[model samples]
Target: ARKGVAKSEQYEIRREEEEMRSQMSCHSLKKRAVLTTDSGNCTAEEASESEAENSSMDEGDDEEGSHEESEVEVLDEKGFRRTQEKKISNVKQTELKAVEDEEDDDVENLLKEEEEFEEKIDFSADTAGALKWKEDLTQKAAQVFLRQQQSTPNLRKLIYGTVVEDEDRE
Candidate 1:
């Protein structure tokens, strides 16, 4: 029974240690991911540094055949690292492009809206101009009608007296 208790305690301790180790590893991976992303932001700077390193590595690679094999392995490692960096940079670039596209679309929409607003303003101005002309026409018509009324003092006399004047001439 004591042995069984000891075994169970050992099992529990081992399980707890495993869990803690897994948690620590997860935390470390998160930290590394964050660092990688932060470093990835300086792509131009890193590219220059990598170019210098590659030149130095190439010089080292030229020494011997056996050294060349070792250099190939190192180059493969560097290649893998570069591919990951490139993927991160590509993702960042695509995100920037998407943001720029959205801004362009917003600008286009604003321009279209402004054009529509200008059209509406122009239409309103034309309508106002037409209304002013209509008002002027009505006033002119009224004045012309008043002048005709003044020329012919009475409507009945103008219609009836003309016949009387013709009969007098006969």
Candidate 2:
């Protein structure tokens, strides 16, 4: 009795495995059929079926077309022209908006550059202020040299021995 029960269990497992294998083979066959259809390898019957589906869909579109025709009749020529003009104006407005945005960006960039330049100038001014005495030293020396030359009054005479000037004085 124990051996018979074990055999029954094994038989049941084998049956389940066979069922799973059949399901997998069916799934793979369906996938291959889809692949072949998508690759444009469908039969004439499949193509005709797809055409029939498309024709049924187009019949629905025909009802929508009648609604559009009714709406067109409701819109007079003047109203249609006004709508066209509104569309043109909207396009122009969008173009102008884009230009204004670009100009705003350019102005922002310029402002940023100006601020950077001002910062650099401020920094340079601070360093230049610290070195101000060096520039003043040369000017101060030049002034002192000029003052000594003016007070002495005879630099050319000392250097050249004052030939014509001393004779004139004598």
Candidate 3:
């Protein structure tokens, strides 16, 4: 009886181990391989193969003639990308055609707008004279340097007295 009980416990432990092996955390599974199809990442070869499969599926769906928006997610060596396409029905197609016809009338207004943008690239002479302050840049900088030098007292020289500066170390 004791031996049978031990055997049953051992069998239960083995079953638990098998279950743990089969079930894995998402993080561990994804990190197992960089380009494994199981983890939603694929190498270039797998990417092309999947694309071919998608194309065949798309060809079959063409017969259904459903105008629903479709989204496709492509996973490849570079990265993952999702693109969506909306299929236009006859009504939307006619709307687009009408918009294009309206745009034809707006082309002349767009050309006229070009003239407005072309004006005033060179400012009026009135504003040009306002830049007279910037004319003597070098002289202004020199004047500012001298003024600051005269205004801020040299605290070090003032503390030590001028005798140190007046002294000829030579």
Q: What's the number of clashes in each of the models?
A: 0, 0, 0
lDDT of 1 by residue, 1-170 (tens): 99999999988988897797566555555554554433432232223222223333334332233223322433455464453344334333333444455554554444345433443343343334323433444345445545644676766557787677566434
Q: What is the lDDT of candidate 3?
A: 0.36
Question: lDDT per residue, candidate 3, 1-170, as tens digits?
Answer: 99999999988988896576445332333333322222121121122222233333334453223211111121121222111112222213333444455553354344234322421221221124323433654455455555655688978678888777666232
Question: For residues 1-170, what per-residue lDDT tens digits would candidate 2 score against the true structure?
Answer: 99999999988988897797566555555554444333331221122122223333334443343334323423454464453344334323333444455554554444345433443343343334323433544355555545644686676677777585766444
Which sections of candidate 1 miss by over 4 Å? 44-170
Model 1 TM-score on a 0 to 1 scale: 0.27
Model 1 whole-model lDDT (C-alpha atoms): 0.44
Residue 115 shift from truth in candidate 2, angstroms: 64
lDDT per model vs. reference: 0.44, 0.44, 0.36
Ranking by TM-score: 1, 2, 3
Q: What are the root-mean-square deviations of the candidates from the true structure over C-alphas?
A: 43.2, 46.1, 30.3
TM-score of each: 0.27, 0.25, 0.20
Measured with C-alpha atoms, the lDDT of residue 69 in candidate 3 is 13
Model 3, 33: alpha-carbon shift in Å? 9.1
Error of 2 at 16 (Å): 0.5
Selected candidate, larger TM-score, 2 vs 3: 2
Off by over 4 Å in 3: 25-170
